[model samples]
Target: MPPLNYGTFFANFNLEMIRPFFKERIAFRRKAPRRMPSLAFTTLPSLLLLGSFTFFLAPPARARLTFHPTIYEEKADYLDTQTVAVYHFRNEGDKTVTIRKVRASCGCTVPQLDKRVYLPGETGVLRAFFAFGSRSGKQEKKIRIWTNEKDLKKPYELILRTEIPRAVRFSPIFLHWGRGDTPITRTVNAWVEADSPVKILSIDEPAPDFSVRLQVLKPGRGYLILVTPRDTAKPKMRRIDIQTDFPRKKPLSYSIYCSIR
Candidate 1:
């Protein structure tokens, strides 16, 4: 993925609008060399016009909002079910600003604010809750803020970054063994981070040709499961499922593949 250059958007906008104004000013300056005193008198009107144009292009300081930190970062553990991220901003402008709407990029992130409007010199905090249902690893989210700041054409973008450490993971979910050959044993390793603790409920029932044995390295979370061929005399195939105590409404049962030929 490519990094986003947010400044380019506004830079292009300002350049396009100011180009014509500068073009006319340059033409007047070139003609002034031909007539000194008459051009001197004539340039006053152009100078006034230039000043007025500058005033029109000046940034609106009367309707501005200042964010303390535009981006919020969170370092979270893999087992964390939910976490709250907060951002603080102040209405630095002299005029009151009304928040038209606040939107988030992901459904798992929800933004909460007290009201829709903010008085001048008032401060507002945005609380966004990130629900880590079954997600892991580094995640980035976006929040768009729309306000009645007349000068702004688009909503301001705020970034939310969350880093979730992968605490638990399974090696290979699928395994196979050749049939009519020497019955060999296959192994499945369940690794858990030293910080996070979890318990293994059971290895769900396997196929008739495959038998399983579970060994615990750590009392609660770590385990080594051995799978052996019960009868490899003929061709057979089986899909073995394993169960755990992980709390997920979505039935996220782990599985393995076994085949003999």
Candidate 2:
């Protein structure tokens, strides 16, 4: 070790300091050749693994249960003895579901569910039968189904309506005459039409105190039925049945309500 010039000493010191850096650079270059391409390929697989993990950890979506003919109905005009069929429903979800029960608004309306548990992508049938015996005018009915799914708890609904036409024309469908505890006389006006001439075979009331009289306002034109209650009758609600025969037609029956008060 001899005394050295300032520049020479400085140069040696710098070379010594940079020697390890150069070796590290060379080692890194050799170890990581094609770094960008390798890193890109490695990054894609890592991202895919992360995505798969996330997918496996996620919860599945809930199943949805539904009805076909979401609404079922019977019209008021349907014959009293007629039965209407409510078609089946299709399930569009990916899981199994069940309809626990089927119900109707009234005994006149009956409901039938084919099966309780339904497989994914299957069809289920529900039939509603309505018995309209002696029922007239506008009517409404409903069908409700209970299900396991929360969203479909109140699952089904149906509507029905009815309309009736008269075979003979009359000013009032119902008539109240004479005196009770309340008003003496009250009348309801109604009209009837038929394809052919119709006649009033007979008029009768179950209560002896209530009487009905048919007046031929115009021969073959139409008739008015005057209902009269005896003055001694007490105030009460009553119904009267009217029976008539038409030429070449089935016997007809009509009912009227009277409020004596």
Candidate 3:
């Protein structure tokens, strides 16, 4: 106690103070059997699974042009030589697009567009002019368009359909006979469409090798032509013209082919 071991006294005092704190911590840990799980380990797999489902199952967003009423159908008059088809479209995308080309299925159908480039939300029109040009009955045409859209695998197609009325129709316009066959007469039938009635006026003089006669089944509506080869001894061919009274810039005419083979 006189010179007193001060170092030993301080060491023993520090050990007594820390020992109780460590003892309490150890007793608390021993009383708890299971530790609380980490939120990271528990929720990470669920979040990962939800993210995978959203990535795989969600529909992709497309940025491209859109067309309204992609198909058009109309009835063309009998006298109409040409008609126009209109298509309205818009750039329903986030970026600008440029139309590369426009093509038609046939030469008679011509496609027209105003400009090549279009901005987002901008709209435009495409017109296709189809010329009948002696074409009749039901007609179908397709116009294809190419664009610089990233996801476009094939060209966009626009369809045009129309039924053209015919002024006249002929059945069996061609008649033929074998070289050594019977010289029997073959009949040709001609009828006018109800919408456009035309009278069969007269027949042009046929070749000397054939004989032609016309009998009007119904005046201005229907007719029958009887044709016979004068002689089937040798090969010969003749075209007989049937004149119609249908008023036009040039008189309407139809032809029948007669051949001996």
User: All models: lDDT?
Assistant: 0.78, 0.64, 0.87
Per-model TM against the reference: 0.56, 0.57, 0.69
Minimum summed lDDT over a 10-residue window in model 3 is located at 245-254
Stretches of model 3 off by over 4 angstroms after superposition = 1-45, 56-59, 177-184, 195-197, 229-240, 247-252, 258-261
How far out, in Å, is residue 138 in model 2?
4.2
Residue 55 in candidate 3, Cα distance off native in Å: 3.6
Look at candidate 3 and tell me the lDDT of residue 175: 96
After TM-score superposition, the amount by which residue 92's alpha carbon in candidate 1 deviates from its true location, in angstroms, is: 1.2
Model 2 Cα lDDT, one tens digit per residue, 1-261: 987799986766757778999999999888985735687789999999999999999877544755556654444322245567666676777777787877888998888876789887888777777776655555667777777776553465655444443465444554443443543445544344656566666666647656666776555556676666665466656777666665353577667766554
Pick the winner on TM-score between candidates 1 and 2.
2
* Model 3 lDDT tens row, 1-261: 388798998877857679989999999999989978898998998899999999999888574878877998999975578989999999988899999999999999999999999999999999999998767799999999999987888899999999987678878888999998989999988888845568877887576888888888987788888998888999988888888867554556778888898
What does the lDDT read for residue 140 in candidate 2? 69
Model 1 lowest lDDT segment of ten: 245-254
Which 10 successive residues of model 2 have the least lDDT summed? Answer: 71-80
Cα RMSD to the true fold for all candidates: 23.5, 8.0, 10.5
